[model samples]
Target: MHTIFGAGGAVADQLLPILLHSQQKVRLVSRTAKAIPGVESVAADATNYTQTLQAIKGSSVVYLLLGLPYDIRIWRAQWPVIMTNVINACKETGARLIFFDNVYMYGKVNGWMTEETAFNPCSKKGEVRAAIANQLLQEIKAGNLQAMIARCADFYGPIGFKTSVPNLLVIQNLIKGKKAQWLGSADQPHSITYVPDAARALYLLANKPEAFGQTWHLPTASELITGRQFAKEAAAVMQKPDGVSAIPGWMLSLIGLFNRPLKELKEMNYQSDSPYLFSSDKFNKAFGFTPTSYSDGIKETCLWAMESGK
Candidate 1:
């Protein structure tokens, strides 16, 4: 049986269908329960050790896909506690673990990022991510738990309503017939992970014993495109003629004075200020799967956004 924490989130949403279709017995755990055909939904707070233990009992694999509030305070206080509970539960239950991770822990990378990159975190959130990731690695190194970390670049997809960057700014603006707004420099190249591709890659990694005890970057399109290019392509897919507008850092700082989330984004603006690339060569070589092209991904996402608004 496979149990997925944070089952209602975007990644989990994409992962569910694939797991069910494969005839796997699945349990979906979240703070609130929702009914899904062929799957069991359990209400459990993963931060609570007892609840998490109950949720993982009898499971063969546990996928940690939890998403906490995007606040430094919340992350600093809760991430470690949640990770500890999950690790202990997995250790006791004898379930293999697969953690869905992000590129934040890498901080500012000068070139393409691979699994071999050193963890030099530049921001507070990055520091927290680094610490949590290291904790997982330590458990694996000790032979206490079998685990793999599947990392991805910034994500955007059909179900990305609550995601940052593309959904909140670009797709939302396009749906309203307004120019897409990009943070920092729009001309710098950046890589984006398609959500369904990420979900599939994570599932694939879980089944491969050789993938354990290491980190794998999820499959991403080979082409690196600028934020401007991304927005223009999205507009073309949406059949909108209006172009994208690059929001200067000074303007974002001014707006951040009253907006807490925007204020928090100030520290990570370095990602957009320059080229950011995350390579998935290791995963591609091992799994032999191709990621969705950006053009196809943008078209599907825009269509979903438009239909979802209706």
Candidate 2:
């Protein structure tokens, strides 16, 4: 059976249908169970070793997709514990592991980032991410586990208003008839992953035994666009006004003094302030995958928002 540790987020929601269509027996584990047809739902806190072990038992492949809250204190306290619990559980259960990860561990990149890019974390959250990722990599390198890390850039999709920067600041704002906002520099080129593409890549990687013990940058469109271009295209797709205001770094830092989420984002402004290019040529060439373009992705995102009332 295929087991997912965190099952209610955007990627998990997208992954569920793919797993089911492939006729894979699926188990979903989270703090609270959500009733999903054709899948077994289990409630277990991953920070607790016993609970995590129970939830992951009897799984062929396990995905660690847990998303912690944005607070740094919570991340520092719980992330290591959770990683240890999950790692030990997967090891004992003999389940191959797939870890869904972000690019924060890379800090700022001068050009296109590949899987080989060194991890020099700039923020506290990035440090946390680097730690957990290293913990997994060390296990993989030591031949103690069969696993891989699937990493993605900032992503946006139908249902990730809270987690996706573009979805929250641009797409949803436009959908709600408000002026879209761009963080940092609107002129800097940015590469944002489409969530569905990420989910599809994960499924492909999980099924291939040779894909284990490596870091893969999930397939993202090769063509990069600036923040202004992204906002304009999203607005065009929604048939809304194309006016977006860029929130300067200083302004965001000031506002973050009161807003907890923005406060958490303050240190990561380096990403938006300059060109953030990501490359997925390894996965693209390996799997013959082509990612969805920005125009098509925005159109579908707009349609999904209107249809789902999100």
For lDDT, the strongest prediction is: 2
TM-score of candidate 1 relative to the true fold? 0.97
TM-scores, one per candidate: 0.97, 0.98
* Candidate 1, lDDT over the whole model: 0.90
Cα deviation in Å at residue 135, candidate 1? 0.3
Candidate 2's C-alpha runs over 4 A off are none
Candidate 2 lDDT, 141-215, residue by residue in tens:
999889999999989888669788899899888878899999999999999899999999999999999999999
In model 1, the clashing pairs are none
What's the alpha carbon RMSD for model 1? 1.2
- Model 2: lDDT to the true structure: 0.92
TM-score of candidate 2 versus the correct structure, residues matched by position: 0.98
